[model samples]
Each structure stands twice: as structure tokens, then as C-alpha cells.
Target: VDGEAKVGWPTPSKKLELYSKTMADWGWPEYAAPAFIRSHIHWEDLDLAAGERVLVPTFRIPTLIHTRSANAKWLNEISHHHPLWIHPEDCEKLGIETNGLVRINTGIGHFVIHAWRTEGIRPGVVAASHHMGRWRLGDDKGRSWGAGKAEIDRDAEGRWHLSRGEQQPYESADPDTGRIWWRDTGVHQNLTFPVQPDPISGMHCWLQKVRVEAAHPGDNYGDVMVDTDKSHQLYKEWLAMTRPGPGPENLRRPLWFARPVKPLATAYVYESGGTTG
Candidate 1:
């Protein structure tokens, strides 16, 4: 971390990379270096449903890091809810009062959550810090102060229906069980998001443009409803958007990129027309 400017960065060339040949070779010369890849959630790309808009799912509060800190009782106490943050103007436009329950519909599923109207966010944008909405399902009776449990039921044809169960009060070794403070166990909105894999990075496009509508009759907090069939449908849809499947792209991720360790040279031998492993 010290005095490496003169020696160069720990890259293949030991020089800071402005242009990534790996990206160029992989078909995205535009992003081979530093350049803005317009976010997937722009107004032009979105076909919003009534009362819906773009969602900023990565927003985080000072108290936690994504869903990992949910078990930290103190941290959870400080930040227990991932309220749907909206601009006050947009909230009015959508008829959503602060703390009002709203249903967010993703491409794959939908979840109900409380709206939080504030001037802090941009108009037409709904931000939900993803870390807070943690739940447990099936036979798992109580809120894990951290993890989740679910209630699972099967029908005549063996189709399954899963729903969120209450965080039951239970006697536990930790005295805090009796005093578990905040009960706003958030929704598992992540389930609702369909996989939008990036053609270059091999990652899900997490920033989603979704529709946020007023809660209809029978919507509840911590509610998540997914149609696995629909999810798979979207999966295939986005899968077709990728450039090429993962494998050695002429060379795997550019041998120059700094990694904790390197693989053998033979590992990078995937030919142009060969199957990607």
C-alpha cells in the first residue's frame, strides 16, 4: 500500500490499466477501460407499470453491510427496516404517505413493504436498502434475530406454496429473546429480482427497474411471492443477452488482472470455437 506509485500497480503489466485488452478481446472494447456503462435502470429502458418506477436496491445505512449484519442484535436494533424510500413529490403522485405499505413488483415476483417519503431521494426513484429485509420460512418458528425460516405447504398435485411465518417468541440462551426489540423483519425482495447477468463481468445486474404500486387488498409486510416458472423464463431471457458464455476469452479474464493467485497457463487454452467450460 505504500510507495507503489513509482513501481507500478500489481497488474499484469505492473502498470495501471486504462484500456483492458481482456474486455476488448471479449467484444466490449468500449468498456476495456474507464467509461460509463449507462445503468440498466434508465427511463428509456423502462416500461413502467401504473404507479411504478426505478428502484435503487443497493442503498445502505450507516448501521449495516447488506444482509450480513442482521444477526448483530445491536446493529439490527439501529437499522431494522429497509423502508421503500421515495421522494415526497413522487410519494404524493403515487398517493403513498410516509410509512405507507406498498407493493413492489419485480420481473419475477412481488413483495410488500412500507414506504418512506423524504426529500433525500430523487423524484421517480425508490430506494430500498436491501440488507434489512431478512426472513425465515417453513417449520423454522422464530426470527433468527438474523436468519430466516419459512412455512411450506403442498397441494394435491405436489406443487409447493411457501409463505412467511411470524417471528415467534421463544425461550433461548440469549436473554435478548424476551426483549427482541424491533419486529419489522424486512421482506426478501432479492427473491423477486430476476437474474440479469452482465455479459462482461459474469454478475447479476442488481440495479433493477421495477414497478412500485400501492398495496392492493391482502398485501403484507415481509411478503414475497415468486413463480419459479416466471423466474426461469426471465432467466432464459436475460441469458440470451450475454455476449458469450464463460470460459477462457482468448485468455481467462486477462492474465494481467491482479488476483490473489494465478491459474496454470494451460487453464487459459479455450479456443475461439471450442466449448466454454
Candidate 2:
């Protein structure tokens, strides 16, 4: 028999064949190898041009520190701000001046961010960390503490009033430790990626091969369209299907309604049990 003859059905062997066949059907030739083997194509083989494709390693929002801990307040108070890190060279090529707002577009999607030029990043790429946008929960007067409350104003005439007051940023508190923190300081990279695969390997590569352009002055990057309604519907359906079942109820009550079960007892005793003076 040929060296490639079919072997007994092992789980790993079967998985490998299944993956290879799936890639073949999807037009991905580079990912047909066994899972245990390292078959990452060399960077040179991809013929990537400078500023064409880049690798971005992202982390969680710093305010939350971890996936489960982000909802806390104290963490957001100290260091939970988010910003996009971009190489100065890349900023220059896209006509994006330092610290200017720029839009990044890929074959599948796009996003806008305020550019931060840093030499620490590789020359050809940009990195946008996540978790900066947050709705303010009424707390303080400053823009960093929580979204400030909006008020309506009217002129001498009794016309309807509409005005958006500046928002105080959100401050997160750690549920377990009661520590307060800031939210904008965190890094959220997932927002910049797309749900696409590499053509050769069929490996899910979230980062996009895209271009950057300077956004018009006074333009807010968040206003750009990232996904269509159809795509959003698909994503919603997928989320509903994959989310875990609800867990136990939250037993901790809000601070305002807490009550002690019993009253404190006070004891008064003289030097002697009787009046011994």
C-alpha cells in the first residue's frame, strides 16, 4: 500500500483530515496539516509589503484588569483609560498628523481612532487598544468620573429645550474589594478586528490588512459605521446561541437597603454588683 494509505480511525487523525478537507473546500491550502504540527507560513512567503499587513497583540481593558473583574469601580478610578497606539511612520504615510483622528479600513470592516504616535511600535503598523467608550453613570462633575447628567434649558420664549451637558467619565468599582477605578484608561483591541480568515491557512486572523486615512477635522471617530444591520443581526444570533446559561442570582444587595438583623446590646456594671461605696 502507498505510504498515504488510510489508517485506523484515531481521533486526532480524524480531526486532522476533517480540518484539511474543510480548508480545501474553503480554498485554503496552507492549513491542511495536523493540529499538533506547526505549519505557520513564514512571513517572507506571504510577500507582505511594508505597512501592508501587521500583527497586533492586544490585552483586556486595564480598568477591569481581567474579563470577570472589569465591572468594578475602584479599578476604573485609577487606570482605565483607552487609547490607540500607532507608529509615527504609519501616521505620516496616511497623512495623519500626530494625535489626529484617523480612520482605518479593511476589506471586511473599519474603525476610527485618535492617533497616538509612538516610536515603540514597529514602523509599519498601528495598534488600537479597547474599552474606552462608556456611558456615564451619574456621580461627579468632572468628565472623567462618570457621564455627567444632561439638563434642558429654555430662553425667555417657552420653546422646547435641548442641550447635552458635558459628561463625566465612568468610574468603575471592584465588587469584591470596593476599590474605585477609571474606565477610559483600559485597552480594548477587539473592536479593531474583523471576523475573517487567512486565505492560505483558513486560520482565523482577527486583524485586518487595511489602510488609514485622516478623518476630517472635528470628526468623532466613533460616529463611523463599522457594521451593517444584516451583519449585526447575524452577530446577535451567534451571541444568543453561544452565551452561557444564566448563573446564580446576585445575592449582594445595594448599599442603601441593607439592614442588620438584631440590635446591639449595651451592658452597665458598677465596681461591685451591689452599691459597695
The top-ranked prediction according to lDDT is: 1
Q: Find the candidate with the highest TM-score and give its number.
A: 1
- Candidate 2 least-lDDT 10 residues: 245-254
Estimate every model's Cα lDDT from 0 to 1.
Answer: 0.72, 0.44
**Model 2's lDDT to the true fold?**
0.44
Please provide TM-scores, in order, for all candidate models, with all chains considered together.
0.82, 0.46
Predicted candidate 2 versus true structure: per-residue lDDT over 1-277, tens digit per residue: 4778666554433433555443433333455555543222323433233335453534444455343334444555554444557777767666667767666654434445567788877765556544444333234532343232333333454322222233333343523322323223322234434544433323565544556667655544443333444345534543443212111121111112224652222212222333210
Which portions of model 1 show Cα errors greater than 4 Å?
1-6, 33-36, 47-49, 138-143, 147-149, 152-162, 245-250, 260-273
Model 1: per-residue lDDT, tens digit, 35-73? Answer: 867767767676543665888788778888888886687
Return the lDDT, model 2, position 81: 43
Worst 10 residues of 1 by lDDT: 157-166
